[model samples]
Target: MSGVREPAGAYDPVDALLQRAHRLGADPRNTNYAGGNASAKGTATDPVTGGDVELMWVKGSGGDLGTLTAAGLAVLRLDRLRALAGTYPGVDREDEMVAAFDHCLHGKGWLPGGEGTAPSIDTAMHGLVGAPHVDHLHPDSGIALACAADGEELTRRCFGERVVWVPWRRPGFQLGLDIAAVYEAHPGAIGVVLGGHGITAWGKDSAECERNSLEIIRTAERFLAEQGRPDPFGPLVEGYGPLPAPERRERAAALAPVIRGLASADRPQVGHFTDADAVLDFLAREAHPRLAALGTSCPDHFLRTKVRPLVLDLPPDAPLDEAVARLRELHAAYREDYRAYYERHADAGSPPMRGADPAIVLVPGVGMFSFGKDKQTARVAGEFYVNAVNVMRGAEAVSSYAPIPEAEKFRIEYWELEEAKLRRMPPPKPLATRVALVTGAGSGIGRAIARRLVAEGACVVVADRDADAAEAVAAGLGGPDRALAAVVDVTDEEQIAAAFRAAVRAFGGVDLVVNNAGISVSKPLAETTAADWDTQHAIMARGSFLVSREAARVLAAQGMGGDIVYIASKNGVFAGPNNIAYGAAKADQAHQVRLLAAELGGLGVRVNGVNPDGVVRGSGIFAGGWGAQRAAVYGVPEEKLGEFYAQRTLLKREVLPEHVANAVFALTAGELSHTTGLHIPVDAGVAAAFLR
Candidate 1:
């Protein structure tokens, strides 16, 4: 609560505040990502006044503390911020205070030019605290004690008056004023436990502020650890035990697509599945139904997980098909209830109901399935729920877990400030929520296609027979949220099925599939071997069919329209010499596209093909000696084969791997939605391969 004097030439307060934030945020026990704010007051030469002025730099809205940067700080003039209190509006009109923050912004070099990062709702809590440094965090341990029914009494016992208790109030200008009043009244108080929220602490210096924050978190953590009851969630209900690891994963994979379909009614959604110990323990317990319906207490927590998750009526070990059938009914009921909840509390000012679908779904024995417009959001939602579970357990250990009332939840959920934040977000890309699975994506055309899909905002499954190559492509595409590598031999049905399952688990389900795996063997009839003919057919024709079959099954399960494109070759149509086995395999692939297109039309699955000429540059097949064999037959040097092929084409252009990739993207990226069973040639106007 006390601090040392500011030394001469001390480090910038802004830099020191960021270091403090990072130190506190490094531990999950201190705060969740982007859930808290830290601030420091320092003197800066004002650009307008040309004199020293006190400026407060606080973590701006919507930034994680651990990764907080200077740009994320909202620099504000303290004198102006304090002046707003004289013109303060009542609680009902407090939302207007956010707009007023603009007048107090210290910009024109202090922050990014023009308008800077918008201030968070809790900005007043930091500015009005009358301390040189302040922190507000939502650690699970603190939230547990805050949500307890006897939180006021517990706070008194935990801190012995060093930390006071403030009653439940939704975060806003008025709540900030309330905390400032508490800080002024209790000169001995270093922090206060916010009822149904988190904790806040302040100090005379940055170091003291960080120490106070951690002490509060650690003390409450120890209080709960020692006094908390064993099995705080109560004993597991009979017949609701967790399934084996293999079975849990299998069930989650089987149901992820179905849940994704229900959740994506408004827009496409990516999913994340978790069967961690906390989730399983909570799901199997008797208290979950009561606590889950009560929902999370913290504002940041519910903003992600929603007020309540949709819990399954059937147990996890129930008959698989029956459970799935019942799940559809459960989801429908959940939507109806959510719509009613919005109607009950919404007035004219509430943001239009953002989607009635549940964000989190609990399957008793399997695990939890969370969905969002992108993979990162889904993963974060799941993580927040796990935190909620921990809070419930701890609260029940000491006292009953009581979250903020439903009306308050609705108010916060649709607050105009929150709605404004949503509106400020940029529009999604063309293929924003679409997920694509590209076979042979380890190198060549497949790699190009994978990278292209991800660039357009699609989550990609980089599938290939080469493990290292597949991993490299996936890594280049992005982090796990964007692309995941699947080592698969498409000719093997089990591995193909597993790859599709991996796609479903990683990003909900596949919406676009590229069957680009292939092999080539050019030889005259006299020299062609039976083994060569069978191998080509197995890798190209059979592999394409297997991957397509699995893709179709998932698409049907999801009831979402999807695309499958086969990367055939120009030789499929052209009667080129010494290209028997390779040409026959490509021809088989070309016909299969038509057959599947006809069959899958009713299911909203489009089937298409791309026939490309000899792609010599960066071609895995060409680099594997096919180029030398073709060059020998054409009586041209191996290095000059590309030029020779280009001269023979009407356009006289050498086809590269990217050209094949472009053709593949064209067939599936919605521009050709109405076109199917079609083969667009990537070859440079090869007259012999033109389709009638």
Candidate 2:
């Protein structure tokens, strides 16, 4: 009820406001990373005169409040802000309103060297509230009430006389004016609920403002608790037998690629699947389809979650192949329905709308999937939709789910201000959104390939028989989101299968597979044992076959074109003394590449191979003590092995692992888009191994 008295120590109002902003923004239940804002009014020494002047410090637009700094707060004079608010008779365009706010910035009030950052759109409202501190947030509890069918009545009942209620209005000059008018009418109110938007609370200081806001949210939470709704997803918990644990995870993994492919038809996207309790509960509800159609709880959510999610019903026992086909059909229908909705609602003067595609996909019996340009954003979008499910359920439990009107959705979704935010993003890399799996990627040529793929913006899976080595390489390339580690023995079928499953779980699916795992035995034909021959072929020949088979299955199911690459050796094409086992197995691997290319070409899968000669440096095979033995067979000093091979090539340069990786990149980078069933030699121009 009273303002928080200044603390006994040295006090800085700006620092105090920033501290509260970070606290509110850190709690997703209170406000998401960039969703909420805070402001404080204080006195500062006038630059022109020796008198004190009033200044308002509001969170700047487009900065994350959780990481707010002094520079992130835009400073403006209170008198100028009020004057700008008085000029807005009813409504104005986004640019015009921004221009007015920019004009009100005090010349010397900003933090030293802090200029150009625009104040939040709520600046005028904060100025008009006549409070020393103001906080605006889209708290889940407050939004649950704001979106209820009987929102106004519920507000009155929940908060009694402590809060005022304002009807939904687009956030800008007009909304600020309405908030000010409502505040004047209810001078005793400490907080105001913006119907279909969020809530705002004001007080004499940062502590009082945050306290009042939390009190309002607490009231809403209590009201929802009393409604007494049982959890709908208790049956889908970990030990449930309806859909066995392994089968549920497998089905979700299979469905992910299909969902990602549909959502990213025009462009590439990454998908994140969530089986959180709230999501599963929403899916299990009987009125889910109708409830999900009601749209997002707030207008700000429209930018990320979209107006509605695409819902699919896949029975637990349904075959994945059939489910994939059904998903494609349903996705087409969703797009058509979205187009119809736009046509029915577009004003006569509006421009042609962008394609209507869903950002979140809801699949019953599996999970919910969200798509974005990358993993972080996909996860964020999914989190927002999960929160939406909670808010919608809370509202429905008390009464009916009432979202903002469709016209409002259109305005916010197509607004130039919102469109500009997306357009400002940097252009994506060539391999952005694509996922790659590199076998034996713990070191040498395989690790080089993984690093190259990640540098090109591809999410990479580093697979090797050494768990620690694989994890080290993956961590070096990028963290868990962009790079995953899998300890897999290429000779084992089960390990290979599990590795691919892990890849699909980490990223939505794999767009490229580099079968680089291999071994070598440099024994003469007469001295080669059956065990040595089997070991060589098991990795180079059989391993490539199995990895390619799994890659084909996943890529074909996605209905998107992909690439498969094999790391062959020049010995396969050029016979070398005492290279019986190694040469024979690599030859088999190269031929398999051709056969797969012929078979998978119709499915939009490209198969290729790279043959490099004597890459002694940074080669795991050479580093494993093979270099000394190979040098002895060649009658050269161990240190001169690289020089011997370099002199043999026409180009006279020593081959390196990175040189092989570049050839692999060329095949997957779309430069050789039309060329498949080809083997590229990366041996610094080895004349004998050249394809003729």
Candidate 3:
């Protein structure tokens, strides 16, 4: 108590303090109850017998730090400690239990004698120490270090021998005893690591305790700095060198099976890795350390194996057994090391655990591999470890980071507390998790189509001439698996091919392809240039062919029924002026959809097109306000153009992107499963002609 000081600045208001805790990632659900439980303090004799203790602010059993209520925080006792810890006295009451226990304790005169009842699980420890404030946390860094190869040694080096390190134990009462013993031995120890449990700090007041907790974490961070680390992963992909188109596709094909195998459980989704040279070069630079230092990333990921990556240097047609053997050799060593680590430190009487595997595989000239039970989980593993590699490589800048110990990791991995997170709702549907490749995604009808697919629970890969815009849209969607924005001039077959590859690599497989990319002109056919005609065909016609070609390859290979949608406009069906190039291209798309549907029907690939009427307004093909001017030129008032168009439709409403999206969804939903090569009108009833 020599360092004790007066309370500072009136505790900054409890609300302010709680907000700070949340900002620091404190689990609010575990910190506060619905009815406002503030403190945890009581004695052993009547552990639950404390009446003066107010609301029992126990961290809710399994609430996230972001959402918790005061009532959700339990109100329990401190004095009923002995009876609660005892054989439970064979009595479980519903309510007023704390009050009954308090009356008994009050009769014995050991109770604190107050109006309120109930205390927290940690009440005894909080009150016995006479500290005005206490805090506990399951910090990522601290837990990670606790599960490392040299947890105790690292702790000693980082925090000094004066710090306390308890062995892994079940939480609650057992933890309290372990802590009590440590405190008695090192009375002045300000911080405590409860092994598999968590970390704790106590101070004369709230501010001091908060400062101590943060400082302790800073100390842990310093420990991380002292340890040499590996490199972090670059973005999903890096720079693409000048590789031949065939060679790149071949490389992607080789990786397809392995990727698919990893994602097979969650459906046969595959990750297509590109920019091979960049990923290869990055790995080559770190071959020595990554191989020797094991691997990077967290412990619970051990099922995917430890940090060291599997480096593959086999031939293209190498036998599967041979490849698996090579993987086995790498994993055997990793598993052995993990076992030895546990053997050296684990108690003689702990339960056995399942062995871990190698989650990361680095193909010499290929990309990285992250294997998991599902595509989503596997990709997360792959990306996170890659990021760790970067962080480890930059350890010189941020300093080396150490992992927590294996035994501690095992305890938490199997901990009941952590297992409770599994009770939440599961993810969305797979087809609902559609993967759509949209051409000309940067602007116009293409962008609208992409947005529509995204709104329908599909992950869209937006390809456009403008790389920045594609990337912007991708970023806006959030997360790699949800959206991929790539720059590509649909006119170039190589970029088009690569764009499809990028989409597959990120989301597993492609479900829908919207050939919505096309260019338009206002010039009369007599004034059109050959170059303009060719460019239009390249994007609107040839571009559509290239994307569909790839989509067919993947869908056929997948054996799962899929859909191909082309965004053809009313120009394909009805005559329109100065639209020779666009009309011709759209007509080509329609013809191809019907022909391809015939050819690919046996393969379960349905091809269709949506012919929209007035979707041209914001399509960039028309100059600013050209739609209005066109209305006037066509002898219809500007305000009546929408009505003029809608009147022709059965729905009597202007066709929006939403209408187009709904049509696309219906086509792909297997509703039109038996229907293919059909042109669905998305322009309300525009095609229902009445010669007025």
Q: What TM-score, over all chains together, does every model reach?
A: 0.97, 0.89, 0.65
| Backbone clashes, each candidate | 0, 0, 54
Runs in model 2 lying further than 4 Å from the true structure: 1-9, 40-59, 67-82, 92-95, 100-129, 182-187, 227-242, 319-322, 347-352, 635-644, 647-652
lDDT of 2 by residue, 168-262 (tens): 88777777777778777887899899998889998877888888878887788888888626642223433222355577688877787778889
Error of 3 at 593 (Å): 2.0
| Deviation in Å, model 2, residue 232 alpha carbon | 8.8
Worst 10 residues of 3 by lDDT: 28-37
Candidate achieving the largest TM-score: 1
The global Cα lDDT (0 to 1) of model 3 is 0.56
lDDT winner among the candidates?
1
Candidate number with the higher TM-score (2 or 3): 2
- lDDT, residue 346, model 3: 49
